[model samples]
Target: MPSVVKWSHYALLAGFSAVLPVAAYAQTEVEAEAEPEAATTVTDERVVLEADIVYENSADNTIIAEGNVEALHQGRVLRADRLIYDRTTERARASGNVIITEADGSQQFAEEVDVGPDLTDGYAIGYSARLPGDATVAAKSAIRRSDGINALEHVVYTACPLCEEDTTPTWSIRARRAVLDEESQMISYRDAVIEIGGVPVFYLPYLSHPDPNSERRSGLLMPNAGLSSTLGAFYKQPYYWAVSDHSDITISPMVMQNVNPLLGVDFRKRFYSGAVKFETSFTHEADFDSDGETFGEETFRGHLYGNGLFAISPEWKWGFGVETQTDDLYDRRYDISGQGDKRGLYSNQPRRLLSQVFVTGQGDSYYTDAALLNFQGLRGEDDAARLPLVSPLAYADKYWDLGAYGFASVTASTAILTREVGADSHRASLGGDWNTMKILPGGFTFEPFAELRGDYYMLDEDVSGKDSVARAVGNTGAKLAYPMVRPGTNVDLMLEPAVMAAWGFSNVNDPAIPVEDSLLYEFDESSLFEANGFGNFDLYEGDGKVSAGLTARALWKNGTEVSTTVGRRWRSRADPAFDVASNLDGKSSDWLASASLKMGKKLELSSRVRLDEKDLSLSRFDMRAATSFDWFRAVGQYYKIDERISPAGTSDEGIFLRGEIQFTDRYSVVFGQLRDISRNVNTRQEIGIAYTDDCSRFELLYNRSELRDRTLGPTESFQVRFSLLSLGNFGSDSFE
Candidate 1:
């Protein structure tokens, strides 16, 4: 049985404080320079004393002392109501209220104790001890090995010093045996009963763990078990493999009644140059209803990924990543959804995975790039989206400086599509310029630029057998802005009036390419000048398009910054080059407006909108705001896309809000909600809270949505969570 102490017993132990005034002592030096096989000799160079001593000579040639005897040796001091010393044998024995103390602020007590001649080995029957901080332990019998090492038989250990009175912890373990090897700094236990509030919660045949001061140990991690309405009862046993100081692997085998046994693995390896990480899962059984049909399409899916960085030279380097996975229901059914929804859309056909490989070199003012691949999984209406098993194409480009007067760049690239609508397209462009110059009575600045572009396309028989087409285009533009300062509140204000006029001409026949990729063509800077600038450039006769637009902007700052922009555009004959519908009878006006504001250092707001001048219909509206304080933070965003275009789907609007609060250092909570305005419904709501204490912690989580439900509530659900995350003295292994 473990040692049990009463209140009076603790008071009695506290009474040992009367011995604190004893002289301090250092350790006796013992020469220990030999091989591992030799008997170690340790020396204690310091010893002190104070006491009422009674000595007795025994037939064993030992000298013993009794009656409130106290002495200090090495870094430890001992006290007892009675003690017997053996001078001839270099050993001592003590009984009746014996207490031992160490220099590091730890104390041990026992009813009867025996000390070794060299202080290297001893035994204390019915001993209890408290280490640094609030950690404490007790046992029916205890033995000291080397240094501060100890072993307790029938022991109980706890980091909560305040819980000393209860031998059977409310939520702790009672071990049949325990060993503390101080020299190696480790602890182990056998035949342990994991109890909670004096009740047995679990029983382990054998277990071992590291002490509070250790960082790594070879042991079994805590097992996890849970029940899900869909997955039934499940359990996961995880094992950790320490490959080295910087690398490790965790393999977890899952067992559940609703599905086949599953094996999940996470491997991490660190090299002198970089690191590599990978995770994968595999299973052998199906857990879905197939309308009573025979097992079809034997379930099989796994994920493998490896990415790292390498130093090519002093000023240049390269890195790449490959994220690939299988199983359409991998996220919804297995709880793997985190990155995006594209991976969670399950289909009977084999799903496609995207993979890309590219390299680029960067310098002070110029950069070069090249890539030999396809952006897999990007499906077009006419072709499948699966990744090609082999490399698709190669391309490269370069950019440079045209002195401080202006800048220019050139690009050339080609690609061969492999799908049914496949075609080989090549593009080459060269552009350069001149900037606006301001004549300042004092000091001023000016900026402007112009460019010329060209393109060539070759068609495959499967696409159109249209042979080929070549076109060239030119554009010229300029902008001038002046800063007007307001010295009233030290606020600098800038108001700029700018205009751009461009003329483009292109010769091509039969609208060279399709319109699959030209959706975002309107209101863009790059399309300012280019052959086939807009898809289906041949839809119009020889491109002789003239367009012009004027923009006004103002920037002002006092304690914070603010900016605004307003612009309008008009073109001759609704230039197809401007992506303006050729059917627009006469000249039409298009307008854009935007504004942003920031106050002090805590709050900010911004908004932008576009409209068609003819009908005055809202094109796009976006707004965002955020604020933070000592205890709370909140952020909100709104996005509205017109019916004209929305990526992948028709236009829709939505709003999202997120906030968090800190009650204390040990407690915090967070909340987030997403609402779809167009559908007049809530997308989702999430909330979570955490609380920590000296011995353990509790976590609560809840989420609600119409699409899916993980809890019992139709629109609301939550879960209670707890684990051994404390017991500070046991380091952080309590959670492992």
Candidate 2:
């Protein structure tokens, strides 16, 4: 039979429900939350009973209910064989198979339960009481709270159900007085004893984890240990700080008994506009344990890196980055990599600080960028092979619609370079070219092009009239090609013949401007139609140089491709030619050609060669090849140079090899080797391996040589990262 209560009683129930926030209930169960501690506290509040239930009044403010016993107050429901409510103390004692259902649908059952009026205080004296998740925490007594804050005395909490069969649990934490703060969303335990199954594991004064829904509750992170042959045994205790919803920081304090104290911190902040990231590591330790007396006190080593990007507008953006090092030996000592020069030829190094602020934008068919690069790391003692100095470079190009034909374009740029010598050199240029084509009915195309260029230069110091040169060039050419190719095993074939005649005027005396910015060319098709293969616009050749070239490109079955371009240049009249100041010159090369061939996703070969018609010697040769199999891949590249230059002033030959292999899903290895054939010496050989698991990533490396003479020995590193992405690693599903 359904029992009815007065409308006033309904108002009281509505008041209680309105005071509390609904806890998250399983989809099938109602989600309810405990009210603020003020109105309903552990020591206050009273339980309201309803349903066709019979109650017997007793002494000590106790009300005993039986037969479909149901107590409802503050959105919490409890049922049992018998119920004892102590009004004086606001505690409810339920016996005979007790089941206390929370507003969140999570329930607690025991042989006996002593709960407060609002279900904020009291305990369940029973065999065991499990949490919402598979985490079953059993103790002699379990205290129940409205906020899901359960205190289990003498408890054994484990996620593993079959204790006997699975003796080794995934992991568990046993503690005294575990407090689950429903408001803050954290489970904190005092005097906690963490264990794996039945084994007595580690002990900590306190421990905490995220509550049911919130996994990224920032707090004390886990500790890790690693052993390195160089650094001995080291331990790290990490602290995580959740500053806000958009920002977080992690500070790791590492202690190496064999060495000194080390501090590493990483900060990440995401704003509504953009993001900013930074990392810094510091270490103080003796050079070597045994040689401590010789080196005296401890050494200070550290590295700092940070960068950020800002989107000013939909099409405009800005970005800046900085990397600095305190000591060169920091890498070898700390097992961090800083090898080679402080700055790789491509690396931007700052002495005090380096920054680049640029606003860039691009549109269909045209683009432009202007950037200010500040390089404080450029020391006057650095060699040309080292990093470049801070300077300003700007380039803008636009394509124009030729009245009745193909297209016309104009490009202009300038640069001022301050070398390590503190000398300033400037180069400026403006150029324009036009291309027009008339297509025949059969698809043969007649294309003619002409370009005019002028150059000027100024230097801080010069000798023998080598400061400036000016030249004018005019070229005309036609391209003939047919797109149709025989089909079968062969998929594509393209052949084109090109001829050009150029007459230029130059003073023939100018200091060479090296191709510093364009050293390595990987994969780019922009070089096909350029007036000069070089990237800069400051130099040009003159004096009636006629050139002829043929291009052939083919694609075979299974995605195989081959392309080749061969051309020869002949000058009607010539005087003593300029020297090989930079490699991109045709003073003595009678024939220059480049070719590339790729075979079915496995192999790729490319070569560029220049021949000295007079000496019958190879002036320059660059070759590269790469191949990949199922589990392994390798690539090799070689460059050679030959010129009538003194030993002190000479070109270089080098070879580089890169390889990688995947051992398994969890592990992989990589290797890189660079050898300088010019000096008959191996520059570097590095091997590295990375291992990934649920908890974190571990990296091991063995490099014979690095950045320079710095040697990174067998070093092992471990990083335990915790993020929203890592929540899956917990593997805690099926909440009970």
Each model's TM-score, in the order given?
0.67, 0.61
**TM-score, prediction 2:** 0.61
Give the number of the best model, judged by TM-score.
1
Best by lDDT: 2
Residue-level lDDT tens digits of model 1 in 185-274: 456677888665567877888765555445554444666666554456678877776667888888888887666667888787777665
Model 2 over residues 1-736: C-alpha lDDT tens digits? 0000111111122222321221111110111143444333432345555435444355564455676666665777766677655556755555787665656554555687554455445555764543444344456665545655545566555544434555454445556666555567666667877554357657878776655345465776666665555566778877888888888899999877567778988899987767878778997765552211224566776877677777787776666665666654454466543332332113453333455555566666566666556554324354443444545666667888867977887776666666654445566667777888777787666666777665566655443234644445444444444444455554767777665554555443344544334434211123433434335443344455555677888887777888888776555454333334333344433466789988854988999876666765776788999888867788889998763422235777889998877799757676778887777666677667755433233345554442333233323233322211122222111101
Q: Which ten contiguous residues of candidate 2 have the minimum total lDDT?
A: 1-10
Against the reference, the lDDT scores of all candidates come to: 0.53, 0.55
